[model samples]
Target chain A: MKQQYGIKDIAKMLNISVSTVSRALRDAYDVNPETRKKVLELTEKLNFKPNKNAAALASGSTKNIGVVIPFITNYYFSTVISGIQEEAYKQGYNIILFVTNDDLDREKTLLRNIATTSLDGLLISISSNSDTQDHFEQLMEEGVPMVFFDRVPHHIHVSKIMQSDFDGAFMATSHLIDNGYKKIAHIAGPKELNFTQERMNGYLAALENANLPRNDDYIIFSGFSQANGYTDTVTLLSLPEKPDAIFAVNDRKAVGSIQALKANHVQVGLEFGVIGFTNDPIATVIEPNLTTVEEPAFEIGKQSCSLLIKHIKNKNHEPHDILLPGKLVIRQSVKLSQDS
Target chain B: MKQQYGIKDIAKMLNISVSTVSRALRDAYDVNPETRKKVLELTEKLNFKPNKNAAALASGSTKNIGVVIPFITNYYFSTVISGIQEEAYKQGYNIILFVTNDDLDREKTLLRNIATTSLDGLLISISSNSDTQDHFEQLMEEGVPMVFFDRVPHHIHVSKIMQSDFDGAFMATSHLIDNGYKKIAHIAGPKELNFTQERMNGYLAALENANLPRNDDYIIFSGFSQANGYTDTVTLLSLPEKPDAIFAVNDRKAVGSIQALKANHVQVGLEFGVIGFTNDPIATVIEPNLTTVEEPAFEIGKQSCSLLIKHIKNKNHEPHDILLPGKLVIRQSVKLSQDS
Candidate 1:
C-alpha cells in the first residue's frame, strides 16, 4: 500500500507555508498566483487530491444535489438521470441518489430524513401516489431549493420540468384515428397521477374531435408494465365490441399490447393499429418496430438541473413550469393506411 | 411553506432541556428510557428529523456511501444499481452516484475529486480501459473502505465481487460445441478489460478440451455494442469458410449477430447457432430468442455493497475475491438437438 500524503507535504516540497497551499487548493483569491501554481504543480505530481468534505465544512456549500426517484431500472428514469449526470458533471456538482421504490411511506420517510444541510438542493420525481405536501413545504421553508421532473406533484410552486403528456397523447390518438380506426382504447397509468389524467383527457378530446362516441369500458387505468398491457388488451379483445386500436401510456405497456394481440391471432399493424409514448430502446427490439411519441427525457433532466442550480444560487427566483414536447417516431407497429 | 422545526422546538414542546432531547435522539445510554420515548414521540409529532450534516460533522460518520460507475443507461449496470440501492436502504445509508460515462479521464477526475470524508465507503465499477493504478491505490491507502464489482482492475488488494466470467464463457462455448457445431467464432469486448481476457481464455480452454484446432482468425476483438456484433458477424460471413456458430460476450452483441445472420439469409437456430453472455431483457425480444449465460449482475451489486459496509465497519478486515456463478438459460437461438 502507498502512504497517504498530506497538505504539509506539498508546502514543504514547494518551500512554502501550509496556509498558502491550503488557500491555493481552495482557490481562494488571497493567495498569490505564483505560489498557487507551484503548490498545485507539486500536488498534481504527488497525486494528492484534496478532500471535499473538509472544504465543505469550512464553506457551507457541499456542491451536491440530491436526486429522488421512484425507479432507475426503467429506460425513461435512467435516461433522465444520464442527462442530470451530464449537466452536474459540466457544472462541477455531484448527485446523491434516493430511490423510494414508488412506495409512499418510503418516500415520506426518505424526505423526512434527508440531510438538508448537506445538500445544496434537490431534484425529485415523486412517487405515483404521494399526496402529502408537509415534508416538501417544510424543506422549502428551510431554504433548500428543489426541482421536480417527470412525475412531479401538482400545485407545488417549485420549478418543474416534464414532457408534454397531454399533447403527445393527443397526437398518438389522432394518428390512430387519421388512419381510420374509429374504435380506439387507451392503456393508462394509475388514476392518481397528473400525467395519467392529462393523457386520458387528450385521448378523450381526440375521440370527441373525430365525432366518435366515447366508450367507458374502452379505457383501462392500470399499472405501467408489459403484463398489465397484456391483461388489459386481453380484456379489450373479449369485449362485445372490441376496440381496433390501442394507445398505451408507455412503450413497455405498448409492447405488451402488441404481444397480446399477436398471441390472439390479430394482425397488429394492418388490422389493429397500436401506438405508444416514450420511444424506449425496446421499441426497436420488439417485432414490427413500435411507433411511439419520444419523450424528451434527457433534455428534461438537463433543464431541471440547470433550473435547480439557478434556484440554489438565488433562492428568491420564481418557480416556473417547463414542458418539453415529444416527437412521434413512425414504425411498423402502427398502420400507415387502413383499408376495409 | 411551513416553519422550520428544530431540536429546541421539540424540547420546548415536551417541557424538556435541549441536551436531553439531543441525547435521546442519539440514543445515549445516560438518557432514561421513558424520557427517550417522550422525546421521540414529540419529535415525531412535530415532524422534526435530525439534521444529518450536524450529526456527521460531530461524529465523523456521514452514513453515506459513494458509488462510482461507468454508465447507468444499460440493463446490467442499472439492475446492479437497483441491488445496491436495496441493500443501502435496508442499512439506513444514502448513496451518492458518480457516472464516468466510460471515459478514463473522467473516471480519473471523478476519483480524484471524490469527497472521501463525506462517504463511509465506496463501491466502484471501473471503466473498461482504465490502466493506471495510482488513483485507486492512493484512495485505498487513505483508509477508505472500497469494494469493486464487475469490471474490476487486476492487482488491487481491495475486495471484489463479480460474476464468474471465465466459467460463463466456458459454458456458452461448450454448449455450442455439444449442439453439433464443429466450427465456432467469438465476438469479444475491448482487449484491455480483465473480464475480456478471462472470457477469451474460457473460450480457448473449451476448444482445447474438445481437441479442436483453434483458428486465430475466429476471435474478433472489438466493442460490446450491437453494431460491433453486426459488423463482426458480417466479416465472419464473408470469410472463405464461415464458422457454423457464433458466441458473443454479451446479449446486445448476440442480438446484433442474429440480425446480421438473418439479413444474410442464414438460419440461426437450425443451420447455425448463436449464444451470448448476460441474459439481458433484450435476449427474449430478439427473434428465435437467445440461449445465453445469465450473469449474476444484481447479486454482484448486492454483495459488493454488503462487503464494502463490512470493511467500513471493520478497518482490519481481510479482503478476498468472491465470484458468483452464472447459469445457462435455454432458448431457441441455439439448436436443441443434432437430428440433422
Candidate 2:
C-alpha cells in the first residue's frame, strides 16, 4: 500500500500550521477563502483523505448510517433501498448494508458486533423470527438513533414507517368477496412475521363482515418462495372442500399458486380467483395478469431514512410512526360479478 | 447521545494498563490467559468495540471490502450478491456497496472518492459506457487489490471472473438452428459492454459455421431492459423480411419480446421462437415457460470474492481469468420441429 499523507504532511507541504489547515478544511470562518480554496484544491489533486478516526474523535459524528434488512433480492426491498439512497445522498450520508437472511442468529450476531462508534444512526427491518427486542432496546439506550420500516417490531417505541398491511389485506380479501367468490383461501408468510399476522387479521375481519364461514384449513402458513406458494396451493387443492379463490401474502406466492393451478389444468380466471400483495413487476408478466395491493416501499424507505437522520441530528426528537396506505390494482386474475 | 466507551474505560474498570487490554484483545502471545480472559469478560459485558480506524491504523487491514456494481435490482445481480455475502460472512469481512446506476460519470466519481484506507480490497463491475479506465488504473498503481467481474474493462490486466458468454451464445444459436430456425435475430445490450460484444460474436460464429448468410440488419444493439426488447421486436416484426427466431440478451427483454409477439397475434412456439439469457424466476411465470441459459451468478460472486481476498493477501500473485459455463434450460418458448 502507498504511504497515506496525513494532515501533518499536508501542513508541511503547504507551509501552513496544522491547526490552520484543519480549520480551512472544516470550513471554519477563521480561515481565509483563498487559503481554504488552495487547501481543498491540493487535497483534491492528491486524493488526500482525512483520517476518519481523528475526524470522528473531534466532531463526534461519522456521517455513516447502518441499514439492516432481511434480504435485498426482491423488487420491493430493492426499490425501498433506492428511496433510502436518494435521501441519504441528498444529506451527504453513506449507508452500510447488513443482511440477516431472515435468520435470528445472524441478526443477533450483527447487532452484537455492530460498531456503533462508527455509525451515526441505524435503519432496520427486523427478520421474520425476531421476537426479542432486547438488542434493539440496548442500542436505543446507547443513544444510537434508529428507525424501523416494513417488517418492524411491534412493541418498540422507535420511529417506524410501513404500509397499511391490515387495510391492504382487507381490501384484497374484500375484492375476492365482491367478485362473487364465497370460498376464499389465504396463503400467508411465516406466522412469526408481524405483517403476516396483520394481513391475516384483515382477512378474518373481511370474512366476518361478509358473513361467510371461516374454515381454519383455508389459512396456511408457508414461506415466501414461489415453491412454497405451489406446495401450499397444491395442499389446498387436495383438501376435501377446495376454495374457489386464493389470497397470497405477496406476489411471488401468488404467481406460484397460479402456476400450480395452471399445471393441474384448472381454469384460473373463470373457476378460481387469486390476488396478491406487493405489486411486483412479475404481476403484469404473469398470464391473465395479477390483481395486487401496491405497497409504498420506496416512500417507506425515504421517510424512514429522513426520520432517522432527524433523530441523529437531535437525539431528543420524539419518535413517530408513519403508515402509508396501499392501493388495489385490478386486472384479469379476478372475475367481476354483477353484484359489484 | 450516550458517551461511547473506550479502551481507557475498560482499562480503568479492570485496573490494568490500556496497552495490556489492547494486547489481550488482539490475542497477542505476550498476554497471560488469565489477563486475556478478564479483558474478554469485561469487554463483552460492557459491549465495548475497538475503534476500527485505530485498529486499521495499527494493522494496515480494515476487514472491509468495497463492491461496485451498475445495478442491484435484477435477478442475476441479486443472486450474485447472496453468494458474495455468504463467502464474506465466512471470512469475517464486511462489504460496502457502491452503485453507479450504469452511469460512467457516477462510476468515476465513486471510484475517485473511494478511501483505500477504509477498505482491504475492491470488487468491481464497470458501467456499460465506461470508456476511460484511468481511475481504475490509478487505484491499481496505488497497490489497491481489486478484481473485476462480469462487465470488466478490456484494457485492464487484472483478475476477471465472468460467465462463458461466447460459448453460451453459441449454444443458444445452435439450438435455434437445430430446431429449424434458418433466419435468426439478435437483440443485444449496449455495444460498449464487453459481454455484449462477446455474445454477438458467438452468434455470428454460429451462423458462419452453419453457412447461413449473416444479415447485419437482423442484429440490433438496444438496451438491457424489457422496454428495449419490446420496441426492438416490434421494429423487427415491422420489417418486410422478419426473422423466425430471436435471442435476447436477458430474460426481461425476452419477456418483452414475447409480449410484443403475443400482442401482434403471432404464434410463439411454432411460427416464431424466443430464447433468453439468465434463467430468472420470471421465465417460469411467463407464458410458454421461456427457454434460457442459466448463468451461474452465485458461483461467480463466491469465486470472485475468494480470488480478490487471495490477491489482497499476496500482491505478487498472478492474475487469474475464470470463465464459468452456463447451462441450456429447455422450455416451451422454443419448440423443435420434430416435436411438432
TM-score of chain A of each: 0.89, 0.88
lDDT per residue, candidate 1, B80-169, as tens digits? 999999888777688899998988988887886676778898999999879988889988988889999999989988899989999999
Pairs of residues at least 3 apart in sequence or in different chains that clash in candidate 2: none
In order, candidate lDDTs are 0.88, 0.87
Provide the lowest-lDDT 10-residue window in model 2 chain B.
B109-118
- Determine the TM-score of chain B of model 1: 0.90
Q: What is the DockQ of candidate 1?
A: 0.50
lDDT of 1: 0.88
TM-score between candidate 1 and the true structure: 0.91
Q: TM-score for all predictions?
A: 0.91, 0.90
Those runs of model 1 whose alpha carbons end farther than 4 Å from true positions after fitting are A1-40, A45-49, A338-340, B1-40, B338-340
Count of clashes, each model: 0, 0
